[model samples]
Target: MQQTILEARHIQKQFHDPVTVQVLTDITFSVNKGEFVSVIGKSGCGKSTLLYILSTMDTDYTGELLIDQELMTGQSDAQLAHIRNEKIGFVFQFHYLLNEFTVLRNVMLPGLKLARYSEQEVEHRALERLKMLGIEHLATKEAYRISGGEKQRVAIARALINDPHIIMGDEPTGNLDTKNSEHVFEIFHELAEVHNQTLLIVTHDQGFAERSGRIIEMEDGRIIRH
Candidate 1:
């Protein structure tokens, strides 16, 4: 049997500012270990909102989130921060690499912040991750000096530095061209197939969604299909 690594139940969210609007309604789903799941939806259909909630970045919603079989909803902010750092890795559309840092240093930042390993151990592990992404050769380069695809690969390496249980991407390929997007898709595919890394990606690209292990489609704040 496949083990579920993450589960969301009865997720509902409302936004109140100029007006009160329900962004997510009755969102419920589960992702299994090593499964690459893609969430697809039109813009403003609450895909990002749902992802934010699932990511433990937005906690003002009503629902239950179980990650690794632990109840994560209603947790204290400090608790959530720790879980976000230790258990989850996030890749946004932008690479968000610090331009002033070396590629290797950028990858090593999270591991150092976690402080689970000595500096030497963290450096070794970061190098290993960069090698896994085939970017070890660029480790000494400044982050601003690399190509866009290379930057994305470095971001992936950084995400893996802490050995997160789940990797979440918010339109990870949204800013890339066709070639770069395809490259990223292949990397994500390999992460699931070879590394057994669980991934939940929110993407507008249909081709990307179709290639994932599972696709969840949302419309008007509700999951229309899966």
Candidate 2:
């Protein structure tokens, strides 16, 4: 059966930082299984906040979010963590590879903590992902040893090692140079189009955002258009 990857509706979050700050209000969107969707907006538009909410990393919100028919309204912290590790993959602007671990070990960490796959299984899978991203040659190197583009690729491989149902990336290309940014965007495109992985990316790059299957523009804590 086809899966319903994510459904987000009427989501709102307020930040009481010194004063009352309404970050997101009445934001609604849905991403189908194996779809690639981009959220584009200027800074302070609550794009990252929305991504955080959808990833189940932040539950302090008012809204309805469903993953595979599971409502996320009342899941506890532990339950949410389980759901996140097992179901969602995330990429950040900076490649958050553990500086001390080898590329291969870094990729295998998520699966290890989740215990979703055996150690050997995780190793094999991580190697496979590394190979797919053409960074297998650097798998034995420390995370800090690789080049920027290579590190981003390692980050991508790690994100995929779990075979997540959906991948949420927050400004994944914001730190890379032009060439590296294009390369990273290409990887994201392939992951969604060729590999049929559901992708929800928050990007400030207009060029990159235009390539997504659909673009949702956020403004002033609300979705302005699609």
How well does each candidate superpose onto the true structure, as a TM-score?
Answer: 0.98, 0.96
lDDT of each: 0.93, 0.89
Local accuracy of candidate 2 as per-residue lDDT tens digits, 85-142: 8888889998889999999999999989999779999999999999888889998999
Best-matching candidate per lDDT: 1
Off by over 4 Å in 1: none
Candidate 2's TM-score: 0.96
Q: What is the total number of backbone clashes in candidate 2? A: 0
Residue pairs of candidate 1 with colliding backbone atoms: none
lDDT by residue for model 1 over 156-175, one digit each (tens)? 99999998889999999999
Residue 163: error of model 2 in Å?
0.7
Regions of candidate 2 where Cα sits further than 4 Å from its true position: none
Name the lDDT of candidate 1. 0.93
Candidate 2 RMSD to the correct structure: 1.3
